[model samples]
Every structure is written in C-alpha cells, then in structure tokens.
Target: METDVLVVGAGPTGLALGIDLARRGVAALVVERAEALFPGSRGKGLQPRTMEVFDDLGVLDAIRTAGGLYPVGMLWQDGRRTGEYRMFDAVEPSEDAPYTEPWMVPQWRTQQILRARLEELGGKVAFGREVVGLDQDEGGVRARFASGEVVTARYAVAADGGRSTVRRLLGIGMTGEAVDPYPTLVADVRISGLDRDNWHIFPPGGAGDDYLAICPLPGTEDFQLVARFPEATAPDLSLEGVRKVVAARSHLAPESVTELRWASDFRPRAALADRFRSGRVFLAGDAAHVHSPAGGQGLNTSVQDAYNLGWKLGAVLRDGADAALLGSYDEERRPVAADMLGLSTRVHRGETRRGEATRQLGLGYRDSPLTRETRTHPGPLRAGDRAPDARVAGIRLFDAFRGPHWTLLALGDVEAPEPDGRTRLVRGPAPGTYGPGLYLVRPDGYVGWAGDTPAGLPDYLARFGRR
Candidate 1:
C-alpha cells in the first residue's frame, strides 16, 4: 500500500493527527499494533488547551457530552469524612480562555471520539499491523509489518508509546530520571460503598503505610483506583491484589471492589527522546517524551505534539509548501516537550501546584524560526503568542480560525494581504484581546507573524509557500 503519510500507533496522538490531515485533504493511514483501542482510563484529565484542539478538530461537543468536571476531593479518616481537599486551583472561564479547568474524560473514550472524527473525514486505521522493519530514503519511507505487508509513504510518525519500537529501530536515545522510586498501580473498577459525587482520598495512616485514591469516572460506573507501594516493590495487577491493597490502605473491605475493568502498573519516570526527527521519520507523543502522570501533562502534551506536526505535514504534501517547513516541527516542539517534562516532574514531587501553568494556554512558539515579529515595540499579544478568542465585527476569532486554513486578522484598518487559496482574510475593528495590527494566525492557531503594516509580510508568507 502507498500513502502520503503513515502514522504508527492509534493512541490519542496518531488519531488526532489523522483527523487534522484528513481535514486538509491529505491521504494518511493510522496503523496500530494492538488489535483494538486502549481500554484503560489512565490519562483521564483533558487540560483546557486540549479542549481547544478538540474544538478545532470537530470533537469538542462529543467530548463535553462524554465527560464531566472533576469533583472536590473528600478525605476519609477511619471510614469517616474528615475535610474537603481541593485538587486544583479554581479559575473562572473568560472570553480569552474559555476552558478554565480540566475536563474528566477517560483516555479510551477520548481516543474513540478522535477515531470516529478521523473516519468521518475519510481516514482509516489499520489494526494489528505491527511494524517490524523500517527503511527510509530521500523520497519516501518503506515499512515492513509482521504480516509481511510492505507499505510506503512520503513520511512516517512514531506515536507509539514510550517503549516505541520505531524509536528503538531508529536507535534514538532518551534522557530522563525516575520521578519516584515507588511503583504505582492504576486500575478501573466498580466499588460498592463509594459515592460518585466526590473523589475519595485515603491518606497514609502512618509510617510504612501507603495512600490510595479512588476517583469516579464520568459517564460510566467505574472508579479509577490508584495506589503506591514501597520502593523496589512491584505492584500486583491481579483482581485479588487490587482488593487486598484497597482493604489494607482504606477502611473498605476486600469485598467492596466488585469488578475490575482494566489494570496496569508503572514507575513514575520522566524521559525525553534525544531528538524528534530522523531522515523521513519523526517521533511524536510518548515516542518523543514521557512524563510522570502528576500534572496530567502526558496525554495533553502528546495530543498537542500531533497538532503541531499535522499542519506542517499538510503544508508540505497538500499545499505547495517548502519541505523545510517540516524542520520547524522539531525546532518548535522539542523545547516545549522538555519544559513540560520538567513541569511534570516538579508537580509529581510536590514542588509545584497544578495552577495556571497546568492549563497550557500560556504555551507558545515565540522563539520559533517561523514566527516573525516586525514592529517598533510589540504589545502584550505578539508574534508566536496564542491568538486569544474574541468577537470582532460580528465574527468570532475562533470561528474564523477554524478549519485547515491560515487566517489573517486585519484589525482596525491595518494593511493586510489579500486572501488566497489557503489563507482567509478577516477585516474588523480591533478587539481589546488583540491590539490593532495585522496578525497572521497559523493553521494550528498561533500568531505566526505580526506587523503594524503589510511591509515584509509577503516575504514571510513566501517562507510558507503562501505567495
């Protein structure tokens, strides 16, 4: 089989990338080694920025319907309620940032929604196609599957998890440190005595005692159980083992855990791949970076990785853009991944709180080579910053920025370039969110270039093959 791009792994990253490419009319295929989608609710927190990405990918409504807000933590001592513990700092939604808090959706459900959207846009996912061999040349990439099938594509992305076979085959190295020495067990199960309104917390009673947390999963009857064990001790993943841990840690009896839906074990470790690109192949998601699940940054950062690369790939394949545009993927995302890894480790060690930084709305590409800021003195909103949402001249900025097209906001008579096949020009009065200027928003919704006048704008557009 031949395709424009071959995406490995059907996790959130690959599925979201498929949706982005499909909307751009790029022919791409997502291949997964597993027979079906992931079944666990391990990465359940959808940070506010990811919600915006889902909105542009046309899955926000379904996501909102499938999940609910996180509840306050209810502390239990000796089987009696002690006091309420707030998990996150409360923040209200504003026009600039619509999603203020993280939404609770199971990772499995999130992947399902993304897959359905990909299919709706005429994309396909080939299951059980484990890649055993990969060879790339100046033109395209040829991959060999375990079933002896050969597929070639112009580019390939390794979105497979941390133990990525593709990254290993490419001989890429990862630099990281163990966030914690203790092993953790995470599972989805049905419990008998816990209320679904609050996240139940069981603190360690004394020395040598471990803590356990059982949070209710939204849109389902299962509660996610998390427990920590002693250093160098392995976590038991069996049903009986889960029951024993629950009985020992919390006041609940072993018989309270009625059913086990899924279970897994892992040590909290953070690692980042040495690099993100190798010849025609690029690493994304867990393949590029792995985090301690403390700040709920693993899945959110992975999805954003796909979002950053999708448009660059689309530009090179579907549009007449320079192949050099793909280089920015590494230049832009590697630093962000490194920063997030540190943040996750800090949050895991209790050195930081999941506050405004965890929201991820502050992330940007201000220093990216693709960002051009030509002005005497830039305002609060400059090139490479996220263009805030606003209503200008009866048109919503996000509504105008949606879809697989570049947007030019000609605010308050600022000189702007004319609309082209791939660029849409929106002229309106300058909203307070963005001062009066010509702001060129990338397809992925970052201010790529900003200027007071149209001078040098044509040259910047030429870099994206937009002339």
Candidate 2:
C-alpha cells in the first residue's frame, strides 16, 4: 500500500484527519480536486467545540491569531434582542472543560492553517488530484485519480463534499428529502451604514419571511449577507439583482455597497448517507451528512468528524487495536450529524435563531456506553456532548469532556499517580476541588468515568485501551 490512509478532499475534515494521522506517525495522503486552496470564505465561523479540537492539535493559538472573536446573540423576527451570549459564559471550564470561546474565522483561512500544520507534521495534500474512482476489498482499497494516478491504502476516508465521488463508487444512497423553495443567495459584500455589532435584521417574520443575517468579519469592513429568497423571486447574480433584494428587504440603497467579493445562489438541503463505513472505506464530513449552512455547523462538524476518527485510525494502525474501534466513529458521530441536520432544518425554516446553548452547552452524547458506565450524572459535559473549556490552575487549555483517554487531574494535596506512560493527568491547584472525584477523559475529550478510587482508573483504561 502506498499509504496507511488515503483521504479524498483537502477541506477541513480531510486536513484535520491528515494532521492527526501524521502526528501519530501514520502515513496519510490527502487529495483535493482544486488546483489551489479555496480562497473564498465559504463557512466562516468556528463553534466552541471545534476550537477545543484545534487546541488539542496545538493550532488553537495560530487559529486565534488568524481569526477574530465575536460574541453572538440572537435577533428575533419581532426585532427584540436576546443579549449577547458568549460561547464560554454558560459552561465554565474546569480540569474537565477546556475551551471557552468560539472563534470566528473564514473557512479558507482555517484550511490554510490546517494545511500548514499538516506540512509541519511531514504530510502534504496532493491538490488537483481528484479521486475519479475507488474500489475496496477486505484487506485494502484502491483509488484512481483524475490525473491518471492510482494508489492503494489499508483504508480510505472520504472527506469529500456532498456529491462525493467515493460515495457513488461505493453505491451508497443518501436518504433524505430536498428542501424546496430552492435557490438562496449567500453574498459577502462591503456595505456602509449598517450596525456592525448585531446580526440578523428580520422583516416581521424572521428568516422565512425575508430576513437578512449580517455577519461581521474581523479585520475587514466587509460583512457576509445571507439572504433567502422565494424560489420564484430569486434574482440573478448581478449588481442590479443585489440592489433589488437589499432595497426590498432593508429599504437600503444598493449604491451604498462598495465591493461585492462573492455572490452566488445556493439551495438549502439536508441529507444523510445510508452508511458511514463500507468495509475498510469510510465516509465523513459532507460525505456522511449535509445540511444548510445557516447555523455554521457544516465546517465545525466536518472538522470534529476528522478529530474523532484521526486518533482512532492512528491507534488502530500503530497499536494494532481491534477494528471495533473504528465502528465507534459511525456510532458516535452519526447521531451528531442527524441532530445538526435537524437543527439546520429548523434554522432554515426560521423556527429559531442560534442560541447560547445551541452554540456551546447543549451538544453531548449521553448514549455512549463509555459515558453510561462511569458517569453518575453527566459531568460538566456528558459523552457525545460538545466539550466545554474553562480556566484551571491559571493555565488556559481545552478541557477534556468527551470520553476516550483517562485524564488524571491532581487537585489539592492529592499527589498525581506515577506516570503510567499511557494516561494524561493534568495537575492543578487545590485538592478535592474537582468535586471529590477523579476524571478519566476519552480521546475525544469527554469524561468516560470519574471516581476517587484507583480501581475506577484501571477499569476505565482497560475498557478503552488496546486489548
């Protein structure tokens, strides 16, 4: 095999997985159809959970430097305000919860950062090499590229976009209904005389009945304007069309807009693949699920998908762990995708706007066996929960709320157990401050089990560790 893992698509999901695999000394090769990284800002926001994953990759600082932080609040159809809700305000980080704020960065910039990190880890994305065809077998998979190149790998991850070539080759059906009233324009422009502090200027009935979402882009005078139009009323991508929409919706003159960087029409749709993995070939990101970009969860979920699968793939390839470990990827992530699909549908239907809990606190996995066995009540965040970030011992880091690895947090006078070379124990000030219990964090940064006894630690490790 040319590589241990072959990833199709150089977007966030594929790049993230490639970086993690490379960090773990796995031979990962990534391919992208585009000749150059996408320059346009597609998905321009990162959720709090995604930021935590970035922190774990040691690229959070770089992402922070490249991005801007904005406190998000909701604006109702009636024009009532729901005061700004900071991403970290609800869930305080402890030794358990780590990330605090959801950083808003353009998708293009985020991809650049991930690509740079992947290079630092000694892997590079093969751009313009699209996957034309792929065939999988019991031991390995063979992939053919558009550039007349072919390679084989022990496994392949299809991080490709919604219309995945790999998914088609695998004969996997995407089961879902299309959202009608198609064709909405998402344009990013530099407009004057608009309040930059707030988002969403709804016209009576919210997004469904002519509402506009104004997203402030840091370091630039531009803002992303996501406007949904009735299918029959949708206009062409022209200056006159833009002017017409803005005038009809906001009573603002089109001439006030100086520069229009990108303006394109897109339809809102939701879908989920019938399967996530087919033998050794797996589908992730948009390949597994897709939804409207209303809540900005597309890129975030894609990156998280990579984070969940990367370490598992690395461990399995390097440590010779059971193949069952890979099954957990589909088990854990599919539900999150389903939930996001539902959330995006609601957002598209204008049922609600993005809330604080939706942004930070509400996402978790209580169904996982790992969380069910060890947790009495959901820890700061539960399994399948979006991990929270908090300050601990004056050190700021992404907290481990998802279950995978054992996080030995030494609080107070309690000395940390001697290094077992496997567990990651974070020593903090004040003993017994972690609520009289020790935490065992999973690889995805959730608490798998917690207790004061040494027996709990061994059992937790034995359950998740390579047998």
lDDT of 2 at 112: 89
Q: Which digits, one per residue and each the tens of the lDDT, describe model 2 over residues 200-305? A: 4545353544666667776556777777776677646776777666655664577866678778777778899988999999899999998788666788888888
- Give per-residue CA lDDT, model 1, range 272-307, as digits (tens): 999999988999999999999989999999999999
Worst 10 residues of 2 by lDDT: 397-406
Residue 321 local lDDT, model 2: 66
Give the count of colliding residue pairs in each prediction: 0, 29
Q: Cα lDDT of model 1 overall?
A: 0.93
TM-score for each predicted model, relative to the true structure? 0.99, 0.83
* Model 1 TM-score (2 dp): 0.99
Candidate 2 has a TM-score of 0.83
* Candidate number achieving the greatest TM-score relative to the actual structure: 1
lDDT of each: 0.93, 0.71
